[model samples]
Target: METGAVDEASIDSLTDFYLGCGVDGMTILGIMGEANKLTGEEARAVASRILKRVDGRVPVVVGVSSPGLDNLSSLARFAMDEGAAGVMVAPTPGPAVEDRVRGYFHQVCEALGPDVPICLQDYPQTTGVPISVETILTLTRDCPQIVMLKHEDAPGLRKVSAVRNRSGTSETPRLSILCGNGGLYLPQELARGADGAMTGFAYPEMLVEVVATHQAGDVERAEDVFDAYLPILRYEQQPGYGLAVRKAVLKHRGAIACAATRAPGPRLDATDEAELMRLIARTEDKVKELSHGS
Candidate 1:
């Protein structure tokens, strides 16, 4: 399927959603469960529903995180069949096992085919496994379809530079790096040469502005905007209160269904709600002031 000319309605809606909150792309967690535990048909069906909901608007990237290559391949194939813009292969959490991880990605590349691009998700904190630069270079060199890397490692710029430097003066750049820490370190990431950012936060428009302005040769303006957004970003990183904070901000802005999250996580209590509301109010005022200044 061609990535060119996505449906305008879908793009408009998705862009509006992101712009309203300040994010560029959204990552939809695939059917939540063990790979073998879920049937192949069931997994495909779940992926189809998400893609349909997204409606070919806004570059939908599906996650494929099964422990084994077989399951990851199945999900990656399903995502391609369902018309996902891209697929992110996240490493399964565990002790460091290089060969096993490399083998899994090799299988994924073979299964995904050269036509469908893949993004390697390097989230060591959550996955407990880190992909070395050597492995990343090998994958990109061997698999022409592997085009992007979602860098979630701390000091992510170092990783980004490593990938770029290794790729070197090849005719085609090895990979595109996208900052994955929401907007927490976007300015530094972009400065170090990230193509863009994929963050789950309240102000995607701000990110777009940051990228667009920087790309347009206005690094100063981009840095200024990023610094301005620090207050909200800091709030979202608070211990024991990240997603709740995001959901609360979304609800307060009338964007989502509810502040409801999956179980085992506590809901925002009265104090949390009150604090979030206060932050929102201050943020809105800041936005107004910035708008007028601009």
Candidate 2:
């Protein structure tokens, strides 16, 4: 069955969450764990479900961060077959990082054919490695299907410079560079040249508003929104409390079923929970004031 960008069933729940909250795109983290560890067939099944649920109402991008080249290719192919708008591939660390990563992408591009767009997941902190700007340029030049770059580097200006520099090159193609720093330096990054952000915070509306306002050329308005949400962003960055805070805010706003995270992650303490609630209350007041005035 043919699927539209936003109408896929597997991601309908998330898509509904984002659309209702006013986000332009939806990014899903592929959990490769015991229960959810998906084979190629299983991945396709899940992707199919997501496509059906979303019903093409929004663009769905899946994370294809498997450990091996084969796994990455399979997942990318599965997502493409199931109608994902794009696939985000994380860099694999090794002596041959560039070669392996580039080769994996080449294989996936071949398997999925030329039309499937891929996003380079440049998450240096989590991946323990990084893809240089030269590498990005080479990949984009060689594979036209690789369209976006999800940059999660700290001091994100580096990534922005890389993209801008690449764009300045002769015969360079336009590629979307999305900030993935979870709102910490979003405004600055956007000002630098980021197209958008792909974060995991509960308040997608805040992000959507910030990015849209910035893109619309209202720098002052975007800064105001960023400043208003600064408190929540700061609180979420507290050590040993980030994800807990995210889940708390999500639950407070009635966005998710629970603040439950996979094991090995810490649970929020009373103090952390109280802080999260306070941040949410303050943000709510500011948002309400903005809405009334607007």
Candidate 3:
């Protein structure tokens, strides 16, 4: 953000850029979007701008995660009014007990009402809430509104298998399993039955190609394609400094005009930039090599 405010024009440009990248949908105000940094009004404005710019070209899910249910529900309704396809809600960090965590989501669905389709975010690393497989199943059973799970739990391949195994059954209804954590475990997660990836990345086209290649019965080719970008992908997923790297790449690729994040965010030094550029060059070479060999 320039001058500590949301850049509406950048949001519009990025929305169009993502559409060109062949993304299936757009999710705004998510964890990677600095949702916590934006004030309520700023967040709503960003969502509205992106939704209007998209104009139903693809599904747009606005993240409405809030500590208070009233605020959460309020923004959710606003997004729905603005033509959002769905709303994403992550359980607030608190007691990690099963009943409390499960009950919290139940209340969330109730607050969201029946019409809003839910994409449950399960990022225990950020939310401090551990959700078991059974708890997730119970939630889907109890709340038909939860149609997607943003599975980001580390070592979550087993969890993906568990969820997909159940969802494939006759008794359990299906839920879209979109893997996140910046697509760090994407190759393995896809092998474990994940439906797709919904995470931040500099080269979203790489993600689209990976998912497409995997689904076309070319699993090994998918892994090879993913390996070409693994270095940059891993570099961009760094816990504290990742977003800065991501923005820099977006700017470098002409998606956004500037790499400047909001105030109080990271800025890359010369050494960091040199390393990032080297990785980008290497990834480009690797991708070219893979294409030639194919």
Model 2 lDDT-worst window of ten: 1-10
**Runs of candidate 1 exceeding 4 Å displacement:** 1-16, 19-25, 30-46
Clashing residue pairs, candidate 1? 21-202, 21-203, 21-204, 22-203, 22-204, 22-205, 23-204
Clashing pairs in 3: none
**Greater-lDDT candidate between 2 and 3:** 3
Candidate 3 structure lDDT: 0.90
Cα lDDT, model 1, residue 267: 71
Model 3 per-residue lDDT tens digits across residues 10-121: 7878888999999998788888857889999988898888899999999999999999999999999999999999999998888889999888989998888999999999
Model 1 scores a C-alpha lDDT of 0.71
Q: Assess every candidate by TM-score.
A: 0.83, 0.84, 0.98
TM-score of 2: 0.84
Please write out the lDDT profile of model 2 over residues 214-277, one tens digit for every residue: 9899998888888888888877766555766776676676554456444545578788677677
Runs off by more than 4 Å, candidate 2: 1-14, 30-46, 96-104, 238-240, 292-294
RMSD, candidate 1, Å: 6.3
